[model samples]
Target: MAKYHRIIMNGESYYREYRYGSDSYGEMLSEEELVHMLLEEVVDEEIEISEREIESALRRIPDREDRYLLQNYIRCLERVGRE
Candidate 1:
C-alpha cells in the first residue's frame, strides 16, 4: 500500500516527502512523508491553465529548469481545458 506524507504549504516552502518507499525507489515509505500527494494531484488535475498560467508559473519559479517544467504543465492544462 502507498503511504501518505504531510507537507507545509503556507505560502513559503514546498516539497514532497515520498513515503512507503525507499529513497532508492524500493524501500518502504516513511510514516511522515513530506509529499503533498493529494494536493499535488488535485491541483494538477483541476487547474485549467493557459498562456497566462504559464506566465504565472514562470513568475513563481525563478530556476530555468523549474520554469520549463511549470510551463509544460501549464500548457498541458491549457490543452486539457480546451478539450
Candidate 2:
C-alpha cells in the first residue's frame, strides 16, 4: 500500500501543498480560517474549487501571510483525514 503521513497539524503546514496520489489534498479549515481564506481569494473569480478546497484557493493569494495562515489550516484538516 502507498504510505501517507501527516507532516503537521493545528494550522501548521511546512509547505504550500501535500499529495499522496493524483489529486492534491489538504486539511480542514477552522471557521476563522475559512473566512480568512475567502477574504484573501475574493479578488479572483477564475478559480474553480469545491468542498474543503482550501489550498487551491490559497495559491492564488499573493500575500504570504494569507497563504501561511491557510496553509496551517490545510495541515490541520488533512492530518485528520489521514489519521
Candidate 3:
C-alpha cells in the first residue's frame, strides 16, 4: 500500500504521496524537508508571474514604505529565480 503525508507550512498545505517499495528504495522526507520543497515550488511559481504584472501592482502602492518593501521583495524574487 501507499502512504500520504499532509503538511502545513506558512499557511499553505502540501500533500506528498509515498509508494511502498523495497527497503533501499527511498525514505520519507521530514517535515522540514517538505516545507523547504514547498517553499521552493512557491518561489518558482511566483517567478513565473509576469514582470509587467508585478510592476503594475507595485506602481499602485501609495505608501513609500510599502513600495520599498515590495521592491525589495521583487529583487529577492529575481535573485532567487536566477539561481
Please name the candidate that would achieve the greatest TM-score relative to the true structure.
3
TM of each candidate vs. truth? 0.32, 0.32, 0.42
Give the higher-lDDT candidate: 1 or 2.
2
Indicate whether candidate 1 or candidate 3 has the larger lDDT. Answer: 3
The whole-model lDDT of each prediction reads 0.56, 0.62, 0.71
Instruction: Give the per-residue lDDT digits (tens) of candidate 3, residues 9-78.
Output: 7776655665556333334566677667657766644435787998898999999899999899889988
What residue runs in model 1 are displaced by over 4 Å at the alpha carbon?
Answer: 1-57
Predicted candidate 1 versus true structure: per-residue lDDT over 1-83, tens digit per residue: 34433344554444334554455233333333334444555564565547676577578887989888877886788799899
20: Cα error in model 2, Å: 48
Candidate 3, overall lDDT?
0.71
Superposed on all Cα atoms, the candidates' RMSDs to the truth, in angstroms, are 15.2, 20.5, 12.1
**Order of quality (lDDT):** 3, 2, 1
Which model scores highest in lDDT? 3
